[model samples]
Target: MNTHRTAHRLVSRAATAAALATALGLGAVHTATASAPSAAPLSVRPAAPGPDGGWHQNGLHLTAAENKKVNGFVARARRAERAISPGVRAAARISHAELVGFDQRLKSPDSLKRKVATWMLESPGQTVDASLRKINDAVRFTLQWPAGTYSQGVRTAAGLLSAWGNDSTRWANTWNRPTGYKAINSAWRAPRSGQLFEVQFHTPESKAAQLETHKLYEEQRLPGTPPERVRELQEQQDAIFAAVPVPPGAERLTAPARRLPSPDPARRLPAPAPAPVG
Candidate 1:
């Protein structure tokens, strides 16, 4: 469980989910006339696909029992999200919010099982209990504000959330280092169920870039994509993100300082050297 590697993969998936939702026009629908392009529907029923061509189902497929348990957990998490929405909305308003998007969805059984399988390959011996414990984003959301006001918006939201209930700052993560896209990713324990859910804060431009890069990200996930082709997809995404201008004050928004728990020694993997940035 090389914590760093695990964190990187989890955050990458979170970013990808956000980008996909935006691309699908599932985010804030401001105008009734606005329309998004249609694509093939995601399979609601879980059936493991074979590893051929560009598709792979090497990841874990959830058992019927596991799926039932996860579904129950997700339902409780959504209730928690609904309970907290008022406070979040009020806080954003006070922070001079420009636009906000609130969403809560259970990762389809197919998606969750795929991720679990990937985790198993990355860190063998992790049981279903361990995997479920790490599933923190069953209920997720994104918030956006004007470019220059991002810092204030984040601070206000954090403060309000802290005052509202238990804020898991130690478990919170941020991904602002990425070019074009900047986001503060945090988690909180729902008061009643103590289930963890994620919140993402971004600026309008960054959100738009995320939407633009969603297709590329999806393509890169194809099981049989050549390594070189994957690299090309990433470079294309980077180019689009590079063009998104970061407004003044946006760079100063920092994730709270907290020490993350160490990775389970039993599941630890050898840490790889950092990749060089061009």
Candidate 2:
């Protein structure tokens, strides 16, 4: 099965990575005891529209009308993104510095259009502005630490919330689990622009599992995927994540209390790649 093959490859890769790190004069690889570091996500420029004047990404093709809708959202998202990006990146850098120890990187700017497009396509009938607002992870960051420092990672996430609060950033939610998904996924609104962004906290094990399951999940989400095939893919993801040990007290993690309900009713699960236009 693919899962077993992935596991075998991961084990082999982890061994090679560790040995390479030592030989390169780098110290111990910073990751969960059981995991190897996954490759960083690649950033790519927006592709030209497909032959039909529609958009094509990862087998998801949008009609000209859909493409127009998608592009509108993309433009607005980009404007909002530009206004908030500097402050957000600074906050991430400072927070990680203050908290100390973890692997960190921001989502690439060029990746936003497809991300916004995919979100809009998955949820039809929502207006472009409302849909743009609902889009989170436009300026996301992932922080991964060793499993041994699980509690410390939890504390850092809390510390980030507290510090961002002082700077007037409002957070919408925090999901920490072995429950919904393996990592702690949270959305925060930028101080002045009010654009929503995500910050995820993970252990090396969960990160590796995420890396393994990401493509599988994206494929599962594509349109035209048979229901049974979708179920099978979901099961594959579930099994991979089921193997990641949950951090102690992870369930106790919470976002700062909100006075009004979240503007976001429920943010949908993130899909790193596009779903087909159905």
The residue-by-residue lDDT of candidate 1 on 224-276, one tens digit each, is 57899999998988898887767666555655333344353311322111112
Candidate 2, position 99, lDDT: 18
**Tens digit of lDDT per residue, candidate 2, span 1-278?**
99545533433333343234334443222222221123222342235666887767765455676666656654454455444433333333322322112222334433454555566677786554555566676555555656666655455444433333313244432234333358777677755556566666777777788889988987876766899999899888888888888777665655533333223221121111111123
Top TM-score prediction, candidate number? 1
| TM-score for each of the candidates | 0.63, 0.59
Which portions of model 1 miss their true places by more than 4 Å?
A: 1-60, 103-109, 170-180, 256-278
lDDT for position 253 in model 1: 60
Q: Model 1, residue 222: what's the lDDT?
A: 59
